[model samples]
Target chain A: MCTYETSHVAVEGAGKGADGWFPVTEATVYFDHPVAAMAEHTLNLDFLNRARGASARVAVELDATSAYALAQAILERLEAAPPALTGELHRR
Target chain B: MRAMDEAMRAETVKFAGHGGDEIEGYLGQPLGGGPYGAVVVIHHMPGYDRESKEHVRRLAAAGFLALCPNLHVREAPGASPDDAAAAARAAGGVPDDRLVGDVAGAIAHLTALPSASGKVGTIGYCSGGRQSFLAACSLPLDAAVDCYGAFVVEAPPPERGLRMTPLLERAGDLSCPLLGLFGADDQFPAPAETARLGAELTRLGKAHELHTYEGAGHAFFSVDRPAYRVEAAVDGWRRVLAFFGEHLG
Candidate 1:
């Protein structure tokens, strides 16, 4: 399982799906803010749902900061995963 | 100037497709030809606009009958920049399956051309690149080459599903040899994903090749884009010609 930890969140448990595709259940996200604060932000749940369904899933936990940082962190983690595959495949 | 002139002989031809609307494409052929193999060129996300037509012209100059179709007839043209942006916002997005159908239609159009050598192949860039890969996997084609395309290990969405990926899934039904080219710096589908795609192809025992240009980014072959790299694009064109010559011939 691939794991990445950021100041805003800790993401872990990455894996591929049965059909050899990247599954949506690969990440556990932790936020530094509380859930109440996150509720104040207008989250694009549709985008989140689509992302969750097709992309790596993150188990998000809110702390003290805003959801923006948590969302950015998740995006970074997802972006980071693809390069690992490239390195392995073209390892000259 | 000579090359540009040579590429300008392409003519727009309208043909009947599988029912809904009349299909039109830019058809290019060599000035002097003898039953050359046919090629269907798919455009990137910007759709089959000017650059795609130029691509068809270039392929024609290289002795292949190239066809490029406009895949966005269902949408209205954006009036101003903001209007266009708003139109894009309202349209949601073009579905991948419809893009695939456009490609299929282009292929069919090529096959029916009398001057074509029946042998047909495809090449695409960006989104078109993904479609080219899918065509190789799911359709009957002589060969395909993909540039900066996305490949998933898990099954993609039904519209985006080719079921052919990098490491995990095997490209069992791929009828022709495939070639994938990527830039090391492409953000969306990074170099590592391309590597996995190569690994999966290898595992399936399929004839394929993957080439990565070290410092290039996505859409490196697009002359109109800022990402264009002349050296990499030149090399890519050479490789594409060689690959098509080997397979489509």
Candidate 2:
């Protein structure tokens, strides 16, 4: 059963892929079939560089628990860091 | 008894697909001159990967010319299976017209085979299951099999913004005897949904056989996934082989 519940986000970052690293412009997050992970369904995130081709992608498949922890950790780290860390003025 | 067996070969080939687009496909053939049936095994949404190829080989070993077309070549040519699948999903899976074209192309390839018996059928898993049913409705096939496919009766929840709609209305157009294998515990097509599909087919007087295995959920036929149910997969294979034998053979 394909849940077909996909979440997409536009992002600006460089991600290492099969060939090397490339600038990723989009990230698609979905809880669906896992390509490599053992779980039947996992929180999958694909950082994609569409211009660089499909191979230029950084993909991750994580179980629900792991994905939740990752989200919390990301938020906490960002809260503790200075806004200048991203070389930007305000996060808002 | 020995006359029934034949050595088999498997490899990748390409043919014209929907809109004259060329795409790669895996072909498996039994090395024999005696006329034999053919099967077009549709890979699941995971993309055309090893499991689907294994299914092709299995069918070939059973004396059928089996083929599994890469449904993503147009989206990501030369890319790895996982990458291509991701790209295809992002671009909104394969369009219905394109899927039908690919299957038609596969059937053409099989019919052209010198050993082919001129009989071809289709079997698909997961999302491919729904597509298999769609192909049967849209094309003239000898047989069709659906394994734990969803969205045949209900569209992917409206929130997804997917353009797909339930295919039950196409029942009158089905061109072959249908065999539906489902997981009783699957939530997507839940037991009730499959029941609804069966009822509609019955009302339409379509030739079909529907089976739902107990204790199995979505992707129960996937050997690599933890959801695989041996009891279900084993019996399911028996049903598929027998179904194809009766119709394609």
For each candidate in turn, the TM-score is: 0.64, 0.97
* Docking quality category of candidate 2 according to DockQ thresholds: medium
Residue B119 alpha-carbon offset, candidate 1, angstroms: 0.8
The C-alpha lDDT values of all candidates are 0.61, 0.89
Task: Kindly report the docking quality category of candidate 1.
Answer: incorrect
Deviation in angstroms for A60 in model 1?
34
Model 2 interface DockQ: 0.73
Model 2 Cα lDDT, one tens digit per residue, B1-249: 011565888999988778787888999998877488989999999999999999999899888889999998888999999999999988877888999999999999889999899988999999899999999999999999999889899777777877777898898999999999998889878889999999999999899999999999999989999999999999999999999989988
Candidate 1 matches the true fold with a TM-score of 0.64
lDDT of 2 by residue, A1-92 (tens): 48556788999889999898789999999999898899988999999988888898999999999999999999888778876795462545
Show pairs that collide, candidate 2.
Answer: none
> Runs in model 1 with CA error above 4 Å?
A1-92, B1-8, B17-20, B77-90, B151-170
Candidate 2 similarity to native, TM-score = 0.97
Candidate 1 lDDT over B107-150, as tens digits, reads 77777766678888888887667768776776788889888765
In terms of TM-score, the best-performing candidate is 2
Question: Judged by DockQ, which candidate is best?
Answer: 2
What TM-score describes the B chain of model 1?
0.83
Q: For residues A15-53, could you state the per-residue lDDT of candidate 1 as single tens digits?
A: 443234343322223221111232211221111112333
